[model samples]
Target: MQGPHPVAPPLVALTKRAMGGMRSVGGRLACLFGIVAALGACAVGPDFTRPEAPVPGSWQNAGDPRVSTQAAADSRWWKAFEDTSLDRLVELAYHQNLPLQVAGLRIVEARAQLGIASGMQYPQMQVAFGNANAVGLSENIAKIGGLPRNYFGYQVGLDAAWELDFWGKYKRGVQAEAAEMLATIADYYSAIVSLSAEIARTYVMIRTFEVLIDQANENVALQEKALEIAESRFRNGATSELDPTQAATLLESTRATIPRRQTALQQARNALSTLLGQSPDTIEPLLVGPKAIPKAPVTVAIDVPAAILRRRPDIRSAELYAAAQCARIGVAKADLYPSFSLAGTIGLDASTRGTASANLFSSGSMFYLAGPRINWAFLNYGRITNAVRVQDARFQQLLVGYRNTVLKAAQEVDDALVGFLNAQAAAAFEQNAVTSAQRSVELAISGYREGAVDYQRVLDAQRSLLQQQNDLTESSSSIATSLIALYKALGGGWELRQNDPVVPERTQNEMKERTDWDDMLGPSRPQEPKKNAAPAKH
Candidate 1:
């Protein structure tokens, strides 16, 4: 065992309870000397409070029944499209995206940190043991030197240290870390939402490109037929050589685009595949088309500000971080005051300080020291005070950051609405154009067969028809992308993911250890979307 620790904190002014009760320096030290035997209990710290959310009441273009369920963003938003391939892709990314996996590990780290922080409020106990052997001078000669000649001994003991929380600083730190862990959890949810959205967007684009390629091929075929007819007519002296040359030139020009579109289509496929964490070649086939693109717009609900508060992970994370900062401020503030502690050591030992070096466990003369201690920070005037101020400043910064995040979320909803409405209009217009262009091509073919128009006129109509068809394809894809944007903006798809909940790397041991602290961590929020996940009224 050991005596109470000896030290005083800087700048810590002492009042000694009252003028008459003023303790002598020796008295204060004496009380501190046996503090371990004198004290018991946990410390002081402020509990954390989750900040009130400031979300908007309604989205700009929220169309139908809004999802009111919890954490829906973790699930696929594209289930509304009924596209199996898209669902598969989202699943793949959720499982394989490296960033998301890293984010999951981050959550684990936060949870572990929370555990460590919480532990600060508990009584800490430690055990130590030692042994020694030696040979030296005799007792008579050593007696003249006031020392023993030789010695041998061993010792083992336990020690405890507990800072009395008259101020609760450690508890505040625990609260702060808990909030930080919650924030990390939200980050993981956001990653899942992002992964699903990316896969859907890329899948739609790839499908659109496939449709455009088909149109390009048809255009080339029609142009070649027209060029052949023009040449035949010129050879028969029915048309000028100039007309035939122009027709042939247009045919080659239209044909040239096929290669370029093919390249772009391929590239899009590769990019999407990589995002899904697969080899480029692994996704080329998915681009070959017959993709089930979304045609029916999924109606979104207007849950207003509260929905954003509940649905957006970034917003939630920011709130949690803010809460953490608030708790930290309390922690820093607590540091400015003097600390009281209950500490002691019970051990078997012999003096190692003198010539009797080997009698550490001298059963006949075993030496042990034990006591409680009080530490007063009586000197460094500004250090503790400045630490508190620094934490205060940091906390203020987070408050600003949290407000900004909510503001940005509002902006995103507005932007998505504009895009969604425009995409709808464009799709409708492009569909009409394709129908009109197809009719024009049919009319031109009929006239060319009846000799009412030259073959070049038929070629022109066919070319325009092909372009309009490709345009229709592109418009549809854009509309699907817009829908995806809307879903993300609406903050849908946060549901709990499943399988064997992989205990986070940092927590696996603690989980197995079954500490008394386990129950104090609070129940984990339900991790999976309920079977009744869909909008109930709808």
Candidate 2:
């Protein structure tokens, strides 16, 4: 559907540009033809072939008990967390992130390149009309030379040039360009997935650090109280100075961690800001602490390994890159043979001359012409051979890249499962330790004040208790962070986005003018817009 506006800028510019281009050839119709000489009109080079996907039916040694997965890999797993803040953050990133924005621009670039490549298959024609003055030069020049030049000559004609795709070289180029466009699209998907993961991870870490800092502050207060009690007992000769001094040192240690934790929090936020394509300052307010963790959902499907390809954007990007390389190789191979092409031009021109050297166009001249042409490169066969080799090497390199992407995807899922599981167990253990230590601290301080126990015991109990409190908080953060990693490793979000990036209304209208030259001799007709399939991402 078109937007509710008249003559958007994109359309206006495209219209002007197309008109300029069409007018350049005296607005003539040029006959376009090709020889495709390779007896088969087939490209002399190897045809593009997709490399086999390394599809593993199942993950190796897979037995991480599936936690409650609320959504499948190809679903928006973040929604499972039930964090409205997280959902908002991801949506914002998709719309405004700079890297994502750049990826969109790349799509435009790829389209322009495709257009250029497609042009190679067509013949080029041009026309010109001008009037030139003639000097006094004719068969009777001596008699006429004595008489000054009298008139001007006018001339007009058509010029045409075309190269055939006999070897299919140009066709291969178009194929490669088309493949490249697909690769760029995959790249856009990959960027979106990566940004979502970074944002989620950073957000989790921010909350975790907040919890850690809060616990540290609380522990320091408890330690201060313990130190004061120990000092009192030492003055009364009920405890040694060693006990009071140790308690003070312990308190200082906990206090020292504060600045470092603060710095780390800032850094994670800064990193996240850049990923969102903003300055750190821009993100500070947008991503403050205390973001609610999504409700843990109980049963997301843990898919088979083969499904990962369909779920992960990086994997798809890699595969498409490989395909692009394969197509380019076909383009290179097609260079080894000859090509045939045809072209024609029809236009009118009239000119006038002042001097009479010999005028031809003065009476109104115009012409029509058409023909076929051939381009053969047998002597440069070695060069073509080298080009084919180079493309082969590139194809091999991209193939390896694809395999590595798959391997890494598998490894990440495994790693996330392990970390998440361990974090759960560790959190449980730390919770127990905190309860026991807190109880022990209370008893030890009471005993020291009553002169029933040395202050040393009080100091020891205070230290252990504070450590436990800090550890417990850290454990919570760990579990949450691990969960974030697992969700990302499995590829989160994007799949849930129901629409493609909205193109500027003007640009959509503009694209129409570029697609045709009004089909003048045969009235212009508009074709239905194509439907694009957003690639699947788990």
Candidate 3:
């Protein structure tokens, strides 16, 4: 190892002298800290209280056996579809969704902001400095004959200033930032809930299109055989040419539907690819398994309507936003009062004049300044009061917004429940229609082959069968998709985050390479409850 620096001894001695000076004022400093601490105990503005909002005691569909008031067991509600591919897609999206990653980065940014606010409780300004100067005295101003005409001066020292939190300005600032950080965390979970629902919805659409396309192809093959039989009869003088022409027209129309369904399938796949944060070409590999609409569970545990206050991330975020604004009112109010601070400067200074030279670090050259300061903006007409009013107004706005969010959440759950029940009923009727249409087509074909009925009967039965089959497919998809909507409306899927990191490890590694995050990028710190604030239920 390299030897110590040549100037280390003198630096150590200088530090010791500075420490000695600090000890001399330690008694007064302690007294000042005690006074400031007592003052900091009481903040200037109103404390935050959770806002109350109206909610129904139970959902409109609660009486149905398919809906339950019991607490939801799975936050990963998509798994109820019993589709391994959907489960895998949800897992992949949790790790790779671009919007979700953005939401996580916002939490990191908010954490840094909280750190900055917390730091304000300590010394506001601290600086170490050194200077050397050459000075010349004017002959006209120097009346003493022994006075030197020129001199050299040097200085090196430290200075600091701390603005006491007499009005709890810094404390309220910390509270605001802490609430904002929690809001960002809620936003991240909200992103998770949205991403999961959107992926499932898109996957259902893809499967719906696949089933419809298959039905259209099957109709086209059946219609082509019908066209061939009509032409054979017309050639043998048993049927008119109009029958063959009509059969060809029906076959072409059925073939036309395939391209439209294919287009929709491709679009759904591309959308899914975006949600997975991958290119469209890569989506095909993940979609290699069976292309069937996921089955929805018969019953969903939606809990009571009041549970939305705690279960919905957006609702929690809205409440946190109001809490953050409530703290800001205090921060703004604090500025109206006079600020008290302690400012001090200590240093070693020396000068060479006449025939004498003094060492810069000598006790004779030591200098210090210490004092308390007060600043009051008494002359600002009505600006400070108006600023406080502005913050209070904003807090009120957020309170109302939080209430509206609660009402909207309840509305969403109600709408989804109605849709799920109605779609299930419609699917039942469509299934019956498809079964009857299939039987009618078989009878019509048999009558035409035995020369007992006209070819138009065959065409009518075939068209009815195709229409009913497509209707049943659409209705079945609606049943599953409606359940997805209900799950999303109830704010399911965010609990998956309890076992996972908000920010991915790969992203954390990349951020570490760019900056020293220390423990900030590690596991999140436990939140400290604010005095007089309601505890948030996660």
Candidate 4:
């Protein structure tokens, strides 16, 4: 869009610049016509083909035999937790995380770099120049030759040149840059996947801390009541002084745990706030009271391990880097061959005597020239050959790196699967333990009140109950966090970025104020944004 108030250049200068510009442009067009007639050569390089995703037909730990191959991956896996707060938190992180935004900006940078490389495929030079001259006559020379010794001269013409792509050197450069751009896009998705997992993990930790804190407070209350009973009995001369001391000791021990739990809770909250791109107070309102930790869905689905090779962003990025390196190999190899190009000039020049004006557009003033050029690096053959070898070596390294990334992605998913499955089992056992301990605490306390058990027995039971409850909370949180890691390894969540602007509105606005992006920051059009699938129900 044009600025609200536009400024116009002076008409005379505008006309002059336009006229001068066309002189070179017209020459370039004529040269391009001849080049186009001969430009039917193939791009010299190995075309890119995506490597097969080396993955197992089925996950070793898929757990269920009934899982259908047709099951769709969860695009919104966190929503399976059925926790509205977590849903909101993930969405907020997507919008606000600065590091993820920086990743998006890297895509923009790569895109501009690609444009620079692509432009090299076109003519490299075109210029128009004008010159004027005057000379004073020597009367002695004029008398001898009967020639005018005073004269005025003027010249104006185009200069143009284009390096032909017969060996596809420039084409290979464009290919390399295009692949690099894809790699950056993949990295952007990888960043979002990592950010989402971090946010969920931190939030779960906060909730876990909250649960532990509540458990400690409850135990402290129980111990305090026990101490009261012991004090009442001692005052009535019915119990020993040692009994109240033991009760007081138990109460203080439980109370001491509160401060540590509170500290962890605050720190976890702070971490979560940072992930949300906000101040520490940002989560305070959402956590006004204790809330249960998010629970994993009952049924988990996983794609065959091979599916992850296509789904994971890190793997995709590694593969694209390899492709880019492969293209560079061709670009380097092309340096060994002689280069071809075309050069030309066309426009007007005129001379006038006395005070008469020159007619620059007259047929007598017109002139033209055009030709082909070649360059060889025959003396630098060793350098060019070694450069080709270097590119090939780099391409091999990236290819290996891509394979390693695939292996690592599968390993991560396998590890997460084991961790999540075990966490669920452990949480189940802890739930049972909590239940039994709760009953034991009640029985021990009742027995003591009726003088059937000692205060020591009541203390043991209460302590065990508190420990069991805390363990259960940790197990539950683990299940949730492990699920998040699994999804991350599976490369979910980034698909949401499709149809969304790569640059945030605020950042785009700031860029516009500081510099002209010149269509770089415009809406991503032409290319269909990439979408990734999610892991199946567990």
- Per-prediction TM-score: 0.76, 0.78, 0.92, 0.82
lDDT of 1 by residue, 144-249 (tens): 4554455444554556777766566666666677777777777877877777778888888777776777777777787677677767778888778976688777
| lDDT per residue (tens digit) for residues 1-538 in model 4 | 5755332233234345555656776686667656743662545656656655466666667755433345656878888787778788899999998888888898889888887887888888988778988867676553534445677788877788988887777877877887787778889889988998898888788888887888888888878888888888789887789889988988898899999989988999888888888999768876653467877875676667777777888887887787788778888887787788778776677777635666766655666676667788889949988998898898888877777788788888878878888888898899999999999988987887777888788888988988898889888988888888888888888888866778888999999898868767644445622211111112
Stretches > 4 Å off in candidate 4 = 1-40, 65-70, 130-155, 234-241, 287-290, 347-369, 449-452, 513-538
**Candidate 2 has what TM-score?**
0.78
Backbone clash tally (model 4): 6
Mind giving the per-residue lDDT tens digits that candidate 2 earns over 1-538?
Answer: 3565454354344435544555535324332331133343565555544455666666543554555333366457667666777777777777667777667657667666767877877764444434454544465545533444444444434456667666666766776676676667667777767778777777777766766777778888888998898888789887678888888888899899888889988888887777666788887677544644333443335667766777787777776666667767777876666656556653333323324343332222334455455667889949988998999999899888888888888888777766767767787899899899988889998887787887777777877877787777666666666666766767766564424642333444565557641221111112211111112223
Q: Which number leads on lDDT?
A: 3
Best by TM-score: 3
Q: Is candidate 1 or candidate 3 better by lDDT?
A: 3
Clashes of each: 44, 22, 0, 6
Candidate 3 accuracy as TM-score? 0.92
Clash-forming residue pairs, model 4: 299-538, 300-537, 300-538, 301-536, 301-537, 301-538
lDDT of 4 at 280: 90
TM-score for candidate 4, residues paired by index: 0.82
Encode model 3's per-residue lDDT on 1-538: one tens digit a residue: 3674454466557767866877858677778778877877788887787888999988898899887777763787888999988888999999999999888888788878888998999999998878999998787794566758788989987799998898988888888888888888889889989999999999999999998998998899888888888898899999889999999999999999999899999999999999999999999878767878888877878868888888999999999888889889999999999998888887788888756898887777778788788899988899999999999999999999999999999999999999999889899999999999999988988888778999999999999999999989988999899899899889998987754666789988999888888666544446533432323434
Question: What C-alpha lDDT, on a 0 to 100 scale, does residue 242 get in candidate 1?
Answer: 74
